[model samples]
Target: MAHTAGGTALTPAMKIAIAVIGVLVVAGIVVIAMLNTAGRDGAEAPPSSAPTTAVAPPTTPGPLPGATPTTGSEVPPPTAAPGTGLPPLAAAEPLVAAPLPKSGSRDGGLVAGFPTSVAEPMEDSDVVSTSIATENTAMQVSLVSSTTTALDEIRAHYRALWTSLGLREQPGDDSTMAFTGEFESLTLNVRTTGTGNMYTIFGVLRTE
Candidate 1:
């Protein structure tokens, strides 16, 4: 053994002990490092392949229970009413004043066997309006005022006049009268106006 200044040299036993302690420490460190690496790998590993719960989308509202479905086409038009095919009623015009057989003395009066009469020539009595004649038919609407003649008397007068002319009376009520003959037909409608002293008469005449 050699002695240095103020120091002693180490023995082989002491060196062996130190070497074993270092080996033990290194082994412990390696074991701790392996445990830490295992913990980290477990935390960072990919998840399992099992199916996940799926979140459903929100729902939309539907139509009411009894609602009817609409179509793209347009609705159909309404049907026409019954008995609307007759000619329209129009206002009367001036008369043509053609000569007629058996006509009344009044200037605008009906011809013999006709349905209506012109207003009598008196104060405030005149022909109001007449219709233009077609090929074989015409109409006249007039207003007649009389202080002496009642509505019943005028109606009766017309009835008697039509019967005397050999025109057969068609079935009608008090407000309407119809007469037919061999070559002509007539229709008369009368209504009282203004205190029952004036009467409006509408007549249609047709000739063969």
Candidate 2:
């Protein structure tokens, strides 16, 4: 065998072969040792918990900028009553103030008991009607169709019924005439007032 450096007994081919085998054995042992250690560690260790990712902090809601909260003392609503749609009422007439006055006559021509009187004359185309009223008595006089044309004829008729009866013909004020008369039964006071053509008669008839 040929020795290269010092006084070695091995040949060059043998040294090469020995070095290759030793490298192979060491590589094999290293692989087996690594596998054994991995098995042992894996078996002995407890299961690893998953990495606890840093959890985000719970998000808090922000308050509104200028909002106001309501208090408990709020105003209550109004309640309506029943029967809201009733109709309007009408105006009333006024009452008369004074008691009826005494009849116009003191005699019993128109009435038997009470004194004050008022009267009216109605002249239609063909007929005439007279109405007389007294404070205590009432009388109605009617003039039928007659050919009398003069107002004196009507006045004389009433005067002749009660001889001392006088005629106060009120053409303007509130009446047309206030006739005072005395009949055998009572005294009569007749007041006649006219508006346009229709004549109203108010009377007072009483005892003499």
Candidate 3:
């Protein structure tokens, strides 16, 4: 030991040893910090072959078996009543109207019982070529081609016409209309065919 001014002094060898220990401690702390940083980076990184969730496609419903699908705004034809002897409702035939006789006889045209004021004859090339009428009662089958009128309009026209004439509308199907008054009754059958541009009107009238 060497005595200095009022204190003991360390030797060169001791000082050198203390300095080396301090350097070793700092180096150890730096290596631990670097290892900790590398571990955190590895934990945060995403793997290249990670599993992913798959999305499914949407499904659509289909019609059932033996079912026919309807198109557009047209309603399906109604079921036939029992024992009517009439075939299942089918598309109407496209009939062209012929020139009428000069005698004003709608013989091959609409039935006679239809009100002349509310009913008008169609064009020469748009009406059925023949008509069926019975005596003592105006029962007729006539087909009139309609290129501009809609089915609802035609239905409404007849409804308003009969109601104004003091007739009550009878319940019927989509292809048929019925009206009954105190002394008269009428039935109208309507259908569209041939590109849906032509309409056929069948009429039956009875008087008391």
Candidate 4:
């Protein structure tokens, strides 16, 4: 006599088929769960709103060579030192004395009626010579040549003048002298006396 299994009346082949169907159902559920998890992770988060770095504006190159730029402040003027006073007196007003005569080639180098006694001796190397008008109305009387002979003559002439006038010649300072005379004014005399060339310069200044 054949006996049936206690659990179910299903055949062995049918039971195997049922087990396979049950596994399939479980796998499908697992796949669905995995897909749901992946979807949750894949959804894009709110688009990032953070700001990006900004680029700086371009700088302009300096004005082209020699070309003046229209922009920028001008340089300040230089300051002068304190108490230095204004720039030296411009030759605006004639520094020279006026009332000078236009005749006789009178110039800054020569004066009219200048005394020969105070005139400096003229050097032979100097192309220009000068003199002062003497009491005898001698013009250009102070100039003497650089040569020894001419110099001796000059010394003798002045020596005679001083002697006649009772004036004394100071020993060493050739540039200065004193003469007391009846002349009415101070005079400048320059002499370039020489046999090679004769030239005279004169200047006269009146003393108050």
Ranking by lDDT: 3, 1, 4, 2
Whole-model lDDT values for every prediction: 0.55, 0.42, 0.59, 0.45
User: Which wins on lDDT, candidate 1 or candidate 3?
Assistant: 3
- The TM-scores of all predictions, comma-separated, are 0.34, 0.20, 0.37, 0.24
Q: Worst 10-residue stretch by lDDT in candidate 1?
A: 94-103
lDDT of 4 by residue, 146-182 (tens): 3333534545554565545444344433333334333
Tell me which of candidates 2 and 4 scores higher on lDDT: 4
| Candidate 4 lDDT (Cα, 0 to 1) | 0.45
lDDT of 1 by residue, 27-113 (tens): 999999999999999999998898989988558545557777567333678987788787985543322233433324243543343
lDDT of 3 by residue, 62-164 (tens): 5557777767435678988779787885533212122311212244455433434334444432554335455543344444554456678777777887677
Instruction: Answer with 1 or 4, whichever has the higher lDDT.
Output: 1
Question: What's the CA RMSD of model 4 in angstroms?
Answer: 16.2
| RMSD, one per candidate, in order | 13.5, 19.2, 22.9, 16.2
lDDT of model 4 at position 19 = 100
lDDT of 2 by residue, 96-190 (tens): 11343333332212333222222222233222333334443333332223333344544544445433333333333332334443421322232
lDDT of 3 at 116: 44
The positional error of residue 193 in candidate 4, measured at the CA in angstroms, is 59
- In model 2, the Cα lDDT at residue 100 comes to 39
Sorted on TM-score, best first, the list reads 3, 1, 4, 2
